[model samples]
Target: MSGTGRQLAVTADEVVDAELVDEGAALSPAPADPGATPAVHTDRDRHLSPETVAAIEESVADSTRRAYSADREAFAAWCATEGRVPVPASGETMAEWVGYLTVTPRKRTGKPAGPSTIERAMSAVTSWHEEQGHPKPNMRGARKVLNAYKDRLAEAKAEAARARQATAALPSQIRAMLIGTDRSTLAGMRNAALVLLGFATAARVSELVALDLAAVEETEHGYDVTLYRKKVRKHTTNAILYGTDPATCPVRALRAYLAALEAAGRTEGPLFVRVDRWDRIAPPLTRRNKDTGIVEPIGDPAGRMTAEAAAEVVERLAVAAGLSGDWSGHSLRRGFATAARAAGHDPLEIARAGGWVDGSRVLARYMDDVDRVKNSPLVGIGL
Candidate 1:
């Protein structure tokens, strides 16, 4: 954090929560000029109540905040080297940055930015300027640069769609990932429960993170989940019976996770809370100790997992299990629909199962691919 070009591979998950959640992470100037003022007005607006402050910080998702923070750092670094005004970046400055991203591979992975990543970075730049009470920098030039970069990505066209649509992972693939984890650890237990529950219910990232302790009920057969809210128009409850496999059973996995939380004196609250690298539940949020002049993880726990964090669970697990693809958050929902259609479930039944509007074109799209392959007339003839 101190250097302009220090170690650069650190991911957002590794950074402290304060920078990711609260708008405290500053867009600092060059490391050579440590005396330069910070972009965040640390002393301003001190009269806001504790609850009000918390609400404002919580207004944005933690994942988005972390992304924005990283964007700020990247812009600051570029500006520091180029001697441009970092805060009130001109439209020309923004356009140049987009052009830079178009050619420059990421420092960690050495992969070029896709259209979506470039667009998000643009949003981050504008957002930081707005947060600092500056007028919105015109991004028309930036948009032009982005469009040109996208046109040059004909070879990457398939890869570009990945940000918008994730490849589905069937039940077998999900089961393999669930079974591959070391459930003895707290993180492992929570992750298994999350992935399985998501696959079983076909829950979207938003719905999965919104669940409270009271929302899930354990019954003799399985678990009954009451989804009081849904992303789609339908608002209804859902229930699931026990899994056939003990090693990857959604009900059993959830039970183990609940038991682990109970042992930690957490009886009722957020169903899924933050877990740190130390395998500890709800690690104290991070802050710099006033006296020590060093940053430290401190303060109250950030209880529930953000939707972005919830979505990452599957991808992390997939990579650990050596599986690869455009698999991610939406994969769980898509996978459920795919699996159900393969099982000969009716389109209406599948639609209701995942909270999609009945007779929806979206649902049909999910079903069509399998139907074409499974019901092909050449299948029995053994092509």
Candidate 2:
């Protein structure tokens, strides 16, 4: 629902005044009845119009609301499976949900729900109940279940946290990997550009794989990469990214890959594509010669790459460079944030580059983790 330049003077606690409402009939709609009557009783007159409800919903940021919606949907599905009510959830239902989330592996990461994740889920459920005008679910039992799980996790907090996160591909390790890569090979050139660009842009695997040939524009300073992703509003320009070293430069690596593809008659389409075991982006596009009825190799257009494929590049390159720990595409992003934080760069700059929302907990955690070891006064002193 939208309003036509109507103003509602709202403060932290209550609505102060409503403007441009004198000439209109107050359309108080409800979720149960979208076409609710504007009729008012003497005793009960507090009703929100659809527009007002929408405005209220917008109080929460769109991203957070999206997460809450997903969590609410997941909880509803679980409730259906367990033969229980989701909205007006009882204490026992909430307890079981907490236990289930603790043990159940997530679809994306294949790990048990973290404490933060569980907490978010609970918040989503509470929001749902409140929206339905029901009392909050008694979560005393749920809190006990969560407390027990947290107690076990507290035993090795550092180890558990580290184990769950993708290992940061630090600058030193990146230099090693870049130096170790053989640029002579097509795969080598592609892999080098993939990792370096991933690091430089702090791009997610999905965003990296979604690039097209036209997305990148070469300039004298460096490349201006225009990325369009959901995390990014419209498109983002990662401009003037320069590397000090020749061997580790993303621009040079990308140029080499583009040159190789052009030689094979591929100058357009997907920026990153599947490179087969035989070191081929694709067999040249073949067509039958109608006159002679003979098929021949034509242009070399390539297939698109997947997010998984992008991640494997990071893991494979890290392994080849003899760097230890579990590396994934996220390593690039995490590494960039950590390194920038360590170098005393502004938090907003790091967050903007990584497409992290303002006041992100994960971003704070990454910086805090770096601060911890160096914080002690005994660190520099050989104790």
Candidate 3:
């Protein structure tokens, strides 16, 4: 089924040994059925070995299975230390046992596992136990523990927020980033277009990279972009926003890029294409030759750029502009918001322009020196 909730016809089905059992199996403490009891068979005849457990996990997604495997391994080690049964734990026993994992020093890191990590371990083990037809431990308490951990994280973020009103590249810094780009060449033009789009729209690096040739339209007022999906929210509609009135900066930058793209004879698809410094069309960086300077067409022309690629573009531009430290792609988005507010745009107006769900989230992220200066003591004290 798709997210629209429409079920598609199944073409084929693969059989697996483990079946998804009833949800009640996790809480029920009795055998599956009360009908005429079949002859009891003890595991002494043919016990399920570690190899069998590992094989069962192979059917799940790689990430999910790895997590479950890690959790089970941790629990098995704990069982060996406590001299308890290495299999299905009773409700009371699991509660008592998981409590120690919260404070127990990790064997590798030699630091106590945090509550959230421990809770995940418990959830994994309980899920496996339930799958094997054993009554699983109560998990409502685990949710409470996880919530408390989340609260701590929230508090930490709040503390950091107090120390810093959002900081982004200043006007001088933005000017520097632009000057740093090699504007004499096609590569330079592409880089300029990338940065300009990000700055004008306050777009995340993901959104900027996902743009297709068809999505951009030159409007009478300015360049209007239609982004299909923005990470800031969950929606199916296109994000329509005017890039600046008259859109000279972004439009000029884009025109240079498009001219280069057309000259290279790519007219029908992606808005951006990678070109090497030597003017050769090459492939993406790979493990074998990642350091070999090559630019390849990204497979998904409308998909987000790799975080590494985005960072590289920003860092290179920042270095060109004569700044140091890890200035990443995100700085452009932050740069736009900060610059807009500095220009005296209202908070709600800025938020609306930036496609923020509300002004608070925008304020929380973009509030900075401009905000402080505009509302500062010096502004009104003399009068």
Candidate 4:
């Protein structure tokens, strides 16, 4: 088989042809018999219609499809470089790919990919084969390789317990971050609302960016934010109550942010928007400056913030507050769970508050450090 040096950008018909050739099915027409009548149709002639194929493709989420495509392409590139067939790849070949990913220096960082990254790439390879009607690659060898890699890390005392690991913002840390936010500008107000509301709801960055003004209902106390979709559940809404302190209140901060948007005549679309370098919200297409006599360029009001942007927000805040540790989008959600557990709340309550559907065990991971100290057997004993 010839390597294309990259994934073959073939159409659906080409894919079908390739599969047929791979299966050794006859593509030529049978010899015509002038004397014979046309044979009756049978079940063997039945096949999926175009509509069915389209529906099948659309069933998977767009993000998942994109990830699978990218992963497959990367694997194909690797296979080309190694003189291996990506499609119908052997178990041995898959294992070799795993090893390569583990040790190969990345172009940008010059560091080998991590275990999780390797696993995800492997999964992508498996998914592509399955989609093309090929037998799934026997991953036993790959699994063994990963297990051995992990064992080495454990021997070196580098493997941390998954449950005991989390980068969370403490209350004081959050307060300092809030104080450091310059709320006089549009960007500052948006960032403040983003961080505050993110912490209060324990929402994932994806969820935070997915919020829309239409889904927000003002309540007597604070506000009710409706999430149309989440990783765990399809749809759910959470109530954010007003805080006693105005400066630290997520509800109050959100209200102020909304007021700013309203003043800009933005009453619809995404709750959070992108602010330009000049600290101004991009005006809508229909908006015009009456005094300047110039039409302001329209921006995407319905655009959702990317996860990278959200992580940058957390990192910026952490640095501004002089707090250390690799802070990311997960800090807000993890921080809420950690802080709640430290406040002596029940595990179940914390789980519910954080939208954890897998029970207390999932929530327990965030509070491992707190649990170690609070539930320690030697708490009363002198060191």
Candidate 5:
């Protein structure tokens, strides 16, 4: 029978094999029930070859794989709870699920999923069904349901946009953050360098954490940092020029940070790493003193920083600077565009600087404050 005709079963083995088994594991046998009908195993339950499994897994990025896994689990859980078949979810079932996601508050966040999240969840559900050899659910009803929630979604989005606009750090605020950072400590130096480089490059948090020591090349003018575009997986080079002032210059800050790393004999690996509460870089291994039985960490020169870690650097700096507004990793990128526009740079130039391939509209979104101040007809009008 075609996959679309398959029915969802409640057996543990069936559910596990259909959704959780990604490593080509052999499926468990169905429960013994001589009085009942025999269980039918589709090709989906068969153990895939290791090579085939590897190839399939490698087809998507690791982040995408993780998201898809979470999505599948959520869908499966919902199905089990509702006593509905997940494998062959009908259009009506999907429509109801979409509606539930829209109106329902998630247990963890205590907030309804946004429109983009709902759309992605639907995509994940579709992908999971297709992977399990089931026909994709017709989404016509789901689309209508989504449309019904469109106004609420738009309002939620508008609120979020306003929040972001409020958080866009100005040049003075950026300077405050930089000056407030205590550069003597290891964590402070690293954070200062990170903030400067991030602002100068207009880099995403992912891009900031993805930097490697080897990717930075010294040039006649300043330094050329090679960054791999996360979306396109393409290499792009950005230049960090030396600032006239030694204190606020990104190049100087990075040099001081590198010097500190070198002083600690760290010559290779990730450009940024996690610093512990004691203001020390976390080492790869922990060593115990043979005599005193004191455990000492040997810093890991090759350790990499996560995107969350990068965001913390921003937040901590913001707190130190005594700024009252909300701050996040994207604040630096937004700050860059806003600062550039305030500095009299055009939209296209700001877009190119910030790697905004979408166009001026996106860049303008980041520079809302600047646009409001400069482009408003009421700017110079007498009341």
Candidate 6:
């Protein structure tokens, strides 16, 4: 499928004026035979591929995909077992499947299927239907059912949330860890920069990972970085909607990080590159033969710095500070909100700082959870 077309010509000045041309062509493999029709080819089949369906599922967080994938496979298997065509099912079949699922316990969660779970399963199937030229299921009715189920889920989640202890690094812990690190080493400097940037910017893991060297900008207002969050959509011409905040966007730590990167003469490409345990440029490693295998040198690492990696960085820093609990990248973001609230920063200011479209929404969802400082009387203060 890849080739270059070239023409060769020979020229002479005073000799017999003549032209000779030779053309080069690449190997062309034979077209694939259209075998017996596939199990799920509809008029809209051209709009989607098996891989597209897989990618859509994968575009969610990694762990969520695990459950969704299982559900998808189970539904597919049930259809196969019943000798039903694997094409898009009708609304009646879907309703029947939902009914069956309500009674059937989930293989992994080992609980009677809840409405929210069923809704997600239906969404997956619904997406499949649209991809295969069938009409989309009525989401409004599905949402009503989902909302009714969500009430039950909300009660369960409340109990769960109560048990889920708040997880975030204390200011003392973060400060101690940052000061304790030997900033002389590249890794140490990078770690310090990461901690500062991670906490100050309150960025998502994907946003931090997407940063390029050029994205970090220094202006009179302080310093700021441009990050394309995963969930945002691009415009018609594929231009990013660059949301800028003032230098208060943790420009200091980011500037320091950039300085170090510049001193090392790395001024382009991904701002965060991999360094292995041995301090070598971490080569691309793939999960092969039940073991990690390094591939020949490639442009980038084997994969993006996943959320797990971002979480691990926080965990390591937490351990350094002798802290515990589910401290991860998310905690860092939450920490920013908590700390900002504790610092008497305006909720609207914090929202704008975090690059949210609406400050009110962030105030309602994130900042509202900030608890008042405990034991203010324990510390000595001037009367």
TM-score of each: 0.58, 0.68, 0.53, 0.75, 0.72, 0.58
Q: Which regions of candidate 5 are displaced past 4 Å?
A: 1-64, 130-136, 150-166, 285-301, 341-353, 356-364, 367-383
After aligning candidate 4 to the native by TM-score, how far in Å is the CA of 363 from where it should be?
A: 4.0
Best by TM-score: 4
- Tens digits of lDDT, candidate 2, 1-383: 12222212222222225743643445743244557786555523445666776676555445466677788788989999999998689999999999999889898878888887788788778756655557789999999998888888887673433236888888888998777778888888888888888888888887888888898899997788877644434467777367788777778878888888787677788888777788888554679999999997663345777787889889888898889888889999899899888888888988877788778888888988787875766697987
lDDT of candidate 5 over 1-383, digit per residue (tens)? 11222211111211334467544334555556779887698776665665566655554555666666676678778989998888789998899889988878888878777666787788878866766567789999999998778776566664422223326665677788888778998888998889889988888888888898999988987899988765444677888999877877888889889999888777888999887788777766678999999987664445678887888888888898789977988889888888888888877776665677654455767667677878899977897
State the lDDT of candidate 1 residue by residue for 27-146, as single tens digits. 543254578766664544435455554554454556665786687788889989888897799999888888998888887768778788877777777766655557778899999988
Better of 3 and 6 by lDDT: 3
User: Quick one: ranking by lDDT, best first?
Assistant: 2, 1, 5, 4, 3, 6
Off by over 4 Å in 1: 1-164, 286-302, 358-361, 380-383
What lDDT does model 6 reach? Answer: 0.57
Which is superior by TM-score, 1 or 3? Answer: 1
- How far residue 312's Cα lies from its native spot in candidate 1, in Å, is 2.4
What residue pairs are clashing in model 2? Answer: none
Candidate 3 lDDT, 85-130, residue by residue in tens: 6456755556556666645677877855665467567767766665
lDDT of 1 at 254: 94
Better of 4 and 6 by lDDT: 4
Model 4: per-residue lDDT, tens digit, 327-351?
8878898898888889999878777
Q: Which candidate comes out best when scored by lDDT?
A: 2
**What is the per-residue lDDT of model 6 for residues 103-179, given as tens digits with 9 covering 90 to 100?**
66666677656665676687666655544445665455445544555565577773322323337554555776566
lDDT of each: 0.76, 0.77, 0.60, 0.74, 0.75, 0.57
Window of ten residues with lowest summed lDDT in model 3: 2-11
lDDT (C-alpha) at residue 329 in model 5:
87
